[model samples]
Target: MAFFRQLVGKILKNFNDRLSVSAAAALAFAVFCVLKAKGKPKFPFVNLSNFMLVLQKKLVEEVIFDGSHILFRCVNQAQWHVTQAEPMIRGKELFKSLVQYRCQFK
Candidate 1:
């Protein structure tokens, strides 16, 4: 009887330890998600209509003039600077600009 009681106590203690570790991990993940979400900007300017307008403006500019290396350098610097913004829209904007500007020269 004593041997069975000891085995049950050991099992219960291990299960409690696992549950505590799991709870701690879950809490950490939730905190990380909240912080990451908080860093995102709720910008209304990321709609499809505005995106099309930006594309049209770029196309017009490209048609009117040849590409400049200075423009490329400035854009690269801008990308490096703005990469710190954790917002998805900012990331998309940076990617779009890099592709449009670099592709024109290449």
Candidate 2:
């Protein structure tokens, strides 16, 4: 149809003029962020138990650690300092004791 053709032409013309994916512009924005923000120091971790203990200690108040992760939280607070810190934070003793309890026969 003539109406459809005209509508499609107008839409494609606008898109061609407006759309952009400039690497230089993206690189400039990234550089601004790197210059503006100071990042946190990374922690050396071997296992979940040690990681969880350190994270719990950093919180403003006590936080309950589920076997695999932290529970629902409050508004002013966040659980872990780092995104990858969760699975690494499990309590070794608690987990060991749980496993023993499950395996032992009465």
Candidate 3:
């Protein structure tokens, strides 16, 4: 009976240790997420409508295309950047539209 009790106690101790370790890991992850969310500004997705608005409002002053990233300076003096994950065709379409819009204004 004593041996059985000892075995059960050891099992419970091991389970408790694992539970504490898991809880600590979860807490750390939650803290990291909170920090990340607080630091980042949420920008609107880059699409046709947004691009049109940028053009219509003359919000974008300069646009820089670097490989998979597009960086632009707004009239408000704020700079915004986006990394494109879409296919090359979509990027080409966006570039064409931007050029068309700029040509119209000029």
- State the number of backbone clashes in model 3: 0
Best prediction by TM-score: 3
| TM-score: the better of candidates 1 and 2 | 1
- Sort order, TM-score high to low: 3, 1, 2
TM-scores for every predicted model: 0.26, 0.21, 0.38
- The whole-model C-alpha lDDT of candidate 1 against the native structure comes to 0.42
Compose the digit string of candidate 2's lDDT tens values, residues 1-106. Answer: 5864674465555555444335434545675677567565453323445444443444224334455544323236654332232444367576455434533533
lDDT for each residue of candidate 1 in 2-102, tens digit (9 for 90 to 100): 86467446555655586666665565567568767879543222343333344444532321112211111121132211122233334455655855764
Global lDDT scores for all candidate models: 0.42, 0.45, 0.62
Name the TM-score of candidate 2: 0.21
- Cα displacement (Å) at residue 87, model 1: 24
| Model 2 residue pairs with clashes | 48-88, 52-89
Regions of model 3 farther than 4 Å from truth: 1-48, 83-85, 88-97, 102-106
Per-residue alpha-carbon lDDT of candidate 3 for residues 1-90, written as tens digits (9 for 90 to 100):
586467446555555586666665565567568768888675545764565567667677877665465556667676574545344524
